[model samples]
Target: MDSHKILSLLGLALRGNHLAVGEEPVEAAARAKDARLLLLASDAADNTRRRTVHFSEAGQCLWLRLPFTKAELGRAVGRTSAALVAVTDIGLANAVANRLAQLDEDQYGEAAERLALKAKRAAERQSELRAHEKNVRTGKYRPKPRRTPEDSSPQVEKSPPDRRPRNQNRSRPRRGSPTRSPHPYAHSRPVKKGKGSFRKRED
Candidate 1:
């Protein structure tokens, strides 16, 4: 039998607080229906074995006799001696039973298979719960309003900007420059006849 693996799992369960050692605690867990599996040491007393059966019935869970003695089981759970142990978590129960079934399929096969299915379903439920919580935290639980084609506003085509030459648009020159008349003769002064006139006036 793979005794080391079973003991290791027990130690893990103990560390996680999923295991209840001793008669009183096991019986309490069984009565509360929190025990997933009950483990009985191979060297347990007849009376202890009988009570384990009763506890299993009360908890509606499976009970298995481990190949390890009370001392070995006890050390696995950090106790001086332990004859009975109640596993509260389904996953741990499944792991321990699966390792046992690998050692002796004829004895632990059915329980392992049942616990495996239960653990799988429990894991799926936990995953779905986490996803739901994430959606709630990120505000994705509410449906967003979608805009349809009919609800969209019409697009207006914009006219292109003027690209014509800028000089063609200027009709006047800049300020501070001399002005020219339309005809040179229009603004010419008449020649005066008083002094040294070179030009004569017609009558």
Candidate 2:
């Protein structure tokens, strides 16, 4: 159950085309009936682990968490990096699982416990907020009303139109059109000398 042996078996599985590497392939393999086991890296992202676990459980496949980092697992199978790998061959799956079980305690249990604790705290916070909302609705808690600046200021009552501007010289700039005086030549008809209004007098 040495780590080296486990890695060698994974490489063999990959070479024989019985291994599914990377996220999508692992998820697909887990969902397929032929998949026998899913191997997840210890440092695999929370989201990746969650997805693979969900799919594996749904497909009723076994999932084993390895102690290696993504790079180590990927390198074992000639990959750049990998979060998951699925074994499609039953014999290889059992061998890998048994090997893993022999050497170490549950490598994944601590992470799972942390996730569960976080979920519990979040649920408790949400429940408290819901209870507070229910109390507000039932009139058990009354929040104080906030006062705005306008509410606090006094009204001036608009003093008597400013007393007609004291001396009337500047009285609202005169509202109506003022009367226009007549033109100087308004009394006389236009001279009828010609249709043209003005012409030189005959000599």
* TM-score per candidate, chains pooled: 0.66, 0.51
Candidate 2 residue lDDT tens string, 73-185: 98999989988988887667766765666675475444334434544675698899999999999999999899899888996787665655466856454669674446767
lDDT of 2 at 32: 66
In the order shown, what is each candidate's alpha-carbon RMSD?
16.7, 14.0
Judge candidate 1 against the unseen true structure and give its global Cα lDDT, from 0 to 1. 0.92
The lDDT of each candidate is 0.92, 0.78
- Clash pairs, candidate 1, are none
Worst 10 contiguous positions by lDDT, candidate 2: 108-117
lDDT, candidate 2, residue 126? 86
Evaluated at residue 174, the lDDT of candidate 2 is: 61
Per-residue error (Å), model 2, residue 83 = 0.7
Q: Whose lDDT is greatest here? A: 1
The regions of model 2 sitting more than 4 angstroms off are 105-203
Q: After superposition, how far is residue 142 of candidate 2 from its true place, in Å?
A: 86
